[model samples]
Target: MTRRPATPLPPLEERRRLREAGSLTPDQLAARLGVAIGTVRAWESGRTTPRGRNREAYAKLLAALAESPTRTGAPGSAPAGGPEEPDAAVVAVGPAKTVSGGRRGRAAAKPSAFTQTPPPSSPFLPFLPFSPFSPRVPSWAPPEEEDPLGPVSDLTPVQAFDALYSFCAPSLVRQAYLLTGRRGLARESVERAFQLAWERWPEVARDPDPAGWVRAAAHEWALSPWHRFRPRHRRPEPPLSDASDRALLKVVLRLPPSYRRALLLHDGVGLGLPDTAAETEASTPATAGRLLHARRAIAARLPELSDPRVLHRRLAELASTEPLRTAGPPAARDGCERRARFWTRFALAFVAVLLGTTALSLRTPPAGHEPSVPPGETVRDVPPRVAPGPLSEKQRKLRAKLREELLHGPERLAPQPR
Candidate 1:
C-alpha cells in the first residue's frame, strides 16, 4: 500500500508559535473557547485538529495579541515562530490533568458593563427655565407689571424699610423712616428687592405665592456675600427729621437679627406672626415669642415714640404722602398679564376649533348614501332608524312555501270548525 504525503497543518503551526512567544497560556486559550486544556494541547502537538469557528477564533486571538502590548506580552516581546522543535517535544514538558465535564464558575462568567438606565422625567426641575440666567426674549406685547403685593416678600435689614418706603411712596417716607429709623437703608433695600424679583420673574410666576418666593429669595440675598462686605451705614442716607424717628432707629438697631426681623414684620409691614414664621421658616410659636420680645424692647427703648399719638402721626403722615408702588403706567404694568391673556385666548380658540372639527367629522355623511337625518338637527344624538327593503327571490320563495303549508294543514282544519 502507498502511504499518502503528510498533510501540512496551519492551525497546529500557529498554536505552537503562540506558546513559544508567550502571548497566551494553554489553560487561557482553552478557557476562552470553553474547551478542555487537552484539546488545545492536542492542536499544538499536531495529534488532533481545530475545526470551523475554533480555527477562526484562534486566528483572531493571535492577531489581537500581536497588535497591542496592553493586551498581550509587553512591548519588544518575542515573535511566535520556532519551527525547528518537534510538536511532541512541547507537550511532554507540561503536567497532565484528567478532564471532567461539570458546571463552570466565576472565571467563566462574561462581563456585563453594557446595561442601560432609565432617564429622569422632566428635563427642567430644581432649576427653572426662566431664571435670571435665562436670556431675555423681547415681546411686542408689553412691559411686565409689578404685582401689587410683590414688595411684601423677604426684607433684609435695609430692604424692610425700602419696601415700606418705596411701596408707600414719598408720603410714607416718614412712616418708613419710623420703621427703619434710617430712611436711606429702607429705600435701598426696597430697590434691591424689586431688582431681585425682576431677575427671577419666571420662577416667581410658577410659585404658589410669588410674593412668598420673592420674600424668601430676598432673605437669602441679605445674608449673601455682597451684604457682608458693605458698610452698615452709607452716605447720602434719607434724613429722618422727626426726633422720635431718630430716637426709634437707635432702639431697633440694638436688637439681634431675629428680634429686629420679628418687629419689622409685625409693626412696619403688617404681616402676622404666623405668616412671618412661614416666610422665615420658623414655627408660629417661636415667631410669636420673637414678636413679643421685639415689641417690648422697642417700647422700653423709646418711651416717647411708643405713645399712641407720636407713632400714629408719623405713620399717618408717611401713608398720606407716599402712595403704594402698586400703581404704575398702564402700559408698563400690562406686560406679563397681556402675554398670559394672549396665550389663554389662543388655547381656548384652539380647543374650540378642535371640538368643532371633531363634531363635523362625526356628523359627516358617508359617500353613496344620503344621511338618514340632516345636519344641525336633534337626530345627530339618536341612532338612525333604518327602513327594511323588499326581500330577495330566495327569501320570498321560502316564505311563500311556508305560508301555503300552514294554510293547507292546521289552520285549514281550525277554519272548518269555526
Candidate 2:
C-alpha cells in the first residue's frame, strides 16, 4: 500500500500566529532559528517564502511552540493548537489552586505583569460623577475614557506656567542676581516677573521663548526704583582672596546696565547672542556691541581677566556665591491667581468704557443737523423752483393757449370741430 503524503503546513501568517501564541517576537524567533532578522521579516511580510530545510525547521519549531505551555502553566499543559476554546480553564496550580475560567482565563494566561486586571473599586469611596471638565488624570489610570479637554500637549495656561516656572525659575534668579548684585532683590524680581508671566500666560505660553519673556521682565523689574524703598538687607559679599577677582566684580557692577546685562546673559547664563538680544530688547548688532564694549571694559580694567577661560571661571565663582531661591509652588499659584483676577477686572472695565462711549455716541445728535427721521417714515416732496426771468413771446402764447383750453375745453382752442 502507498504511504499517505503529509498535508502541507499552514502559510506564513499561520506560522506567525503560532509564534505569537507562544509569546515570541519576530526577532526572538529569528535568533532562535539562527537566521537574519530581515529573513524573518521577509517571511512575515510575504516578500519571500521559506524553502527546503528552512521551511521544514520553521514548521517543526512552530508546531513545538504551539504545543508548549506558556510560562503561566507547566510544560505541555496547553491543549494542541486549534481554535482557542472559550471555556478553557486557566488554573494557576502551584501551591495556590485559584481556578479562574472563561474571559478571565485569557487574561490570566498572559505572562506579562502589565496585562493583569486592576482591583475592583473600593466600596468605602463615594461614587462621584465623572466631569468632562476635570483636570488631567494620573498616568496609571486606564485610558479607555476619552479626555474632553484634549491632550496635555495643548497645555492649559496654569499647566504651562507651572511647567515654565519649574524649568526656568532657578536660572532666572541667578541671572537676576548677577544683574542686581543683591540676592534678595533678584528673588523679588524673578517672582514678580513670573507673576506677570502667569497673567499673560495665554500669550507667553504660545511664544517660542517663554523663558526669554520671563528673563526680560526680570531684567526690567530688577532695575526698577521700587526696590529702594523696601528695607535693604545687606548680604555679605563672598570673600575674594584674589584682588584681581574683586576688581573684576567691581568693574562689572560699574559698567552700564546694558553692557552688564549683555555680559551676564551671554557669558554667565550661557544664552546665545540672539537670545540675549531678545531678552535685552535690542538688535543683534547692538547686543554684539554691548558684549564687545563689556569685554573691552573688563579687559582694560583687569587684563588678567581678559582670557575667556578666566572670565568664565570668575563669573561662575561670582554666581556661585549666592544660591538661587526658588518660590514654592503654592506661592506661585497664588500669585498667578491674583494677577489673573486683576487682568480680568481690568479687561471688564476697559470693555465697559468702550461700550459706554459707543452708547453715548449713538444717543448724541449729529452736528449741524436736526434729528433724522426713522427709516420707515416718508417725507413730503419739495415744490420745484420757478425760473427767475420773465416769460418770452412763445412762452406767453403757450401759457394763454393752456389757460383757454383749461376754461373752454380742448374743442374751443382746436379751431372748433371744423
Candidate 3:
C-alpha cells in the first residue's frame, strides 16, 4: 500500500527565523537535531520538510529556541531588531512562486528591509556579512574572493574548539551553577568540561548533542568530591531583591541532583522533555517523573507557588542570573603537556594490569599438579618409562606363561575339568 507523505512544516522563513533566534548556523542546527546540514538547508529553502519524529523534534526545537534568552532577549520581548509583524508572512509557508520577471525584476522585488544584519558584538566582524546564521545567503557560499569557506570544513582543532566554546560557555556555566550552588565550584566544573571537550574535539564536533555532552560532563564534575578539598572563595551572592525568588532558589538547591537537573533543564533552560532526557541520560518518562516530583516538592514547601505556571516562572528567573565569573573558551594545553599526561595515565594502567595478571598467575597450580578429578572422570597422565634392557630368565618364563593362558582361555581349561 502506498502512504501519503506528511504535510510540509511551516515555510522556510519560519525555520530561518527560529535558527537566528537560537543563534545557530545550519551546520550547528543540523548537529543539534541529529540531521544532516543539507537537510536543514533544504528545510530552510523550502525544498523539503521534516516528517514524523523529525517534524516533532523540529517543532520542539523552534519552541525552545524562541524561549532561549541568548537569542530572544527577555521573555516577553521580540528578538533585537526582529520584525514587528511576523504574522504577515505566515501565508508564505508553501513553495515559493516564480516571479513574472527575469533575475533583475526578482532582485528588484526582494525587500532589503528584511535582510539580515550582523550583530555588532560579533567577534568575527570581518566576516559579518557572510555569517553562517544569516538567512539572506547560504553559509556554504564563499565569503570573499580570497577567503573561501573551505577552512570551515577543514577547521583546525583549535578553531573548532574555539567555535564551540564561544557559543556554549556562558550557558554551560549557568547550568553548572544550578547543579552546584557555589559559583567557584560551577566555574571549576565548566572549565574542566571545556578542557575535556578540547581534548576530544574531533569526536565532540561530530556529536548530535555537543552542548548536552559538555553540560553532562560539567554536571558530573560539579558533583565530584575532588573539589571539596580546594580552597573556596565565595563571591557575594546576587541580592535577594525579591524574597520569594531567593526562597525558591534555596529550595531548588536542596533537591536531589536528579530532580534538580531535570527541573533546571526543562523549566530553567526551556528544553523540551526529550532534550532534557538526553542531557540527563534518562528515559523521557523517567525524566518527566523527576520533573513532576521536583515541582511537587517545591510546591509542598511553598504552598503559594503551587500553581505549575508560577513555579516555572520562578525557576526561570532564578536560572537567568549571571554567573559570578565570566566564562570563556578554555585555553589550549601545550601538546607536550597533553602527551605527558596521556603517557602517565597509560603507564599507570599498564602497571596495574601487569600486577593483576601476575597475582592471578601465582594463584594457579602448575601443570601436572591439578586438583583431583571427580568421580567417573579419569586422569590420563602417562609417566615416562626407562629404556628396556635384555630380559632376565624369570621374566622370560613369566611372559611365555601369560602368552599360553591368553591363547587357550583359562575358562576352557577349567570347563574340561568340571
Candidate 4:
C-alpha cells in the first residue's frame, strides 16, 4: 500500500508560538490531537519530531492557528492580519427602532423628549475611522503606563513571562533574603527561581498564583541545607548596620527551621494565616503552633520586640533593608535555556553510553555452558569375571576336612546321650 506523505511543519519555535497565539494549552492541544501531553511537549520543544498521521494533524492545526491572528478584537473591527478599511469597517450598532408604515405608527414615531440620538462612535473602539482632528491616542495608552493589575494576557509567551517577572521579582528577592540571612544567597535564590520558572513557563503561567509559585521555589532554594557546604555560602555576608536588626535576625535563625519559616511567611510577608499554612505545607493549627513557638522564642531573647505588631514591623524593615536584586528577565530566560541545553546534552550522552554498552555486549563472544565434575575418583571398567569357578578345588578339600573335624569335636566336647 502506498503511504501518504507527512505534512511539512514550521520551525520548532514557531510551533509553540502558534499554539500560544491560539491560547490552546498543551493539554488542550493533546486532547485535540489524540496524543499524550508529553508527546505534544516533545514536539514543541524539539525533543521528538512527529511523523505520519500525527505530523500531518499537528502541522495542520498550527497552520490554522498561524492564519488566524489572535490580536483582533471583534467582528466589525478590522481583522488584525488584513489591511485597514475605514469605510467598510464602520459598525453603527443599536440604531433607532423603525415603526410600521401606518397613521398610528407615524403619530407614535413623533419625537418625544425621551427620544435620544444614537450613541456616538466610541473613541476607544478600534473600528472607528477618525480624522486628524480627532483626539490623539491618550498618554495613558503607553505600554509602561498600563495598569499592572489589569489583565494583559493576550501576549506571546516571552512577553507574558517578562510581565510576570517585572511584577514579582523585587518582592521575591527580598523574601528570599528574609528566608536566608544572606543578600547574595537571596539574589541567587530569586534568580535561580526565575530560571526554573522560565524552564517550566507553561505550567507556571497556568498556575493561579505564579508569584507564589516562584516564592515557594526561591524559599526552598534559599533554605536548602546543601548551601552550607558551598564555599561561597560557608561564610556569612556582612552584618546589617543596626545592632537590633542583627539581634532580631539571630533570634529568628535560632528558632527551629519550620517555626522560623512560619513566622516569616505569616508576620513578615503579611500573608494570611491560612495562606502561610498552605505555602508552608502544614495545617492551619500546625502552622499556628510553629508561628507561636517562633514568636515566643524571639520574645525570650528580645522581649522589647515581643508584640506581634512590633515584630512584624521589625521583620519587614530587616527584609527591606537587604540589597537583594534579580537579573533582568531576558537574561534569566537565556540562562534557563542554557541550563536546559546542558541537561539535554547530559541525558543524550547517558543514553549513548547505555546503547554503546548494549552494542559491545552483542559483539562479544558468549561463554559456553560447562557441566561440573566432582573431585571424587571415577571407576572405569577393567574386566568382567566369573569369580566362583576358580575357588572350587580348594573349597572342596576344606569342606571335607571341616566335616571330619566337626564329627570328632562334638564327640570330644559334649557328654554322650548313651
lDDT of 1 by residue, 189-277 (tens): 43444455544455544454443454444344443335444686544455455564445566766776666666555444434455677
lDDT of 2 by residue, 1-418 (tens): 5332222344433454466556676689899888987687656533455666776677688768666665224444446763333211121100112235642343234321111111234210111111111323322233434542123333455555665665567666766777777767888888988888776766775564455667789889987756657656444655455565467668888888889989887666545566678778899999999999999999897887787545654565455445467786458779878877888999999999999999999999678867777787553332334788887787678677677765743454345474
Model 4, global lDDT: 0.63
- What is candidate 4's lDDT per residue for 1-418, written digit by digit as tens? 5333335566543565466546676799999999998788667544366877887788789878767744222243355575332110011101112335532223223321111111234222211111111212221122232331123334567766776676567767766666777888878888899899988887887665566788889888888889888998878688988787789878887877678788877766545566778898999999989988888888999997788756764665566555566789899899999999999999999999999999999989668867789688754432344575655666668667667765644445567696
TM-score (all chains, Cα) for each model = 0.32, 0.43, 0.49, 0.53
RMSD (Å) per prediction: 41.7, 25.6, 18.5, 26.1
Q: List the residue pairs that clash in candidate 4.
A: none
List runs of model 2 lying over 4 Å from the truth: 1-156, 225-246, 339-418
Off by over 4 Å in 1: 1-185, 215-228, 231-239, 304-418
Q: Model 3: how large is the Cα RMSD against the reference?
A: 18.5
The local lDDT score (0 to 100) that residue 190 gets in candidate 4 is: 80
Residues 249-271 of candidate 3 have per-residue lDDT tens digits of 78888898889889877765545
Position 282, candidate 1: lDDT: 86
Q: Could you tell me which 10 consecutive residues in candidate 4 have the lowest summed lDDT?
A: 87-96
True-structure RMSD for candidate 1: 41.7
Model 3 misplaced regions, further than 4 Å: 1-154, 225-242, 307-309, 330-418
Residue 109 in candidate 1, Cα distance off native in Å: 88
- Residue 394 error for model 3, in Å? 51
How do these models rank on TM-score, best leading? 4, 3, 2, 1
